[model samples]
Target: MPVWGWILIAVIVVIAVVAVIVARLVSSRQRTERLRGRFGPEYERTVGEVGNLDAAEDELAARERKREKLDIVSLPPEARAKYADSWRTVQIEFVDNPSSAVGAADRLVIQVMRERGYPIDDFDQRAADISVDHPKVVENYRRAHSIYLAQEQGDVGTEDQREAFVHYRALFEQLLETDENKDKPKETRA
Candidate 1:
């Protein structure tokens, strides 16, 4: 080929390489934004735990994929009402037996989670899965679980137990709201 033709080919190749790099970068940035939006604080939490952005993103993506495969169904109206009533009873009982009330709150949260189609075989795994849909409340679930563990070891104080109940209530209220919202029409939903 002529010298000009060779130069032209070189310029074309460089342009193609630059374009590919830019496209890849854009795609990577978009993925990061999507994960951040979906996971909220949980995204930062995972990144902190994993110590790397890529690894944390992979872990979060895995959680998303795993959640997609699960049959997470909404609670029926009657079931939701029943669970809400049970939660109210637990709250009222807190006045008489704080420790037992906290324990019952913990169990009720798990029962609601299970009834809503979350797997309860493992606490950590369940929290991870719940984080995919309920990112904001996942931390409350973790805190509540930690308190429950402390209680099991007999190291928890009444104040800590009360705090645990509060954390559990945060997650429980979120779960209940999510279920109730699912039953509402999109135009009527808050």
Candidate 2:
């Protein structure tokens, strides 16, 4: 090819590559921001739910029906398990698997709690001195309880499934270490 033709082709390729990179970066940044907003709340919710297994199961069941009815929550049982397991892991951090960290779960939990009059504060102490017996806390516990139960029936992959389950377990255990809920006094002890 002629020198000019080669130069033109090179320039076009460079532009295309740059454009793709920029698009990817922007997309990733938006996702990160959304996730950042939810992390603390999700961890907190997990902690509260794991502290009370029955309530968590009930909460999971309710969410499952809502998601299915809406037709917007279409994850495979495995994926749902991943999510539930992740929450469980967030509740009790162990060395088995990783956490299923999704922004939607965080946002949904927050919105539901807010609607139920749950007092959600920032991660710090100044946010809110909430107790388990508080109305909001009770509501949150119920929500988490149901969601956790729905996840119990999930199937894991032969290799990856085990890892995923392990990760979920680990995530919950890990959450316990930094469980903000621990700071709150348990009223019902459920």
- The pairs that clash in candidate 1 are none
Q: Give the per-residue lDDT digits (tens) of candidate 1, residues 1-190.
A: 8999999999999999999999999999999999999999999999999999999999999999999999998788788789989988998998898788888998898898898889999999989988998888788789878988888889988888787888887777777765454322121100
Model 1 per-residue lDDT at 159: 80
Please give the distance, in angstroms, between residue 128's alpha carbon in candidate 1 and its true position after superposition. 0.5
Q: Candidate 1 at residue 46, lDDT?
A: 99
lDDT of 2 by residue, 80-114 (tens): 44545555544343223312322233433444334
TM-score attained by model 2? 0.27
lDDT of 1 at 129: 89
Cα-based TM-score, every candidate: 0.90, 0.27
lDDT of 2: 0.39
Worst 10 residues of 1 by lDDT: 181-190
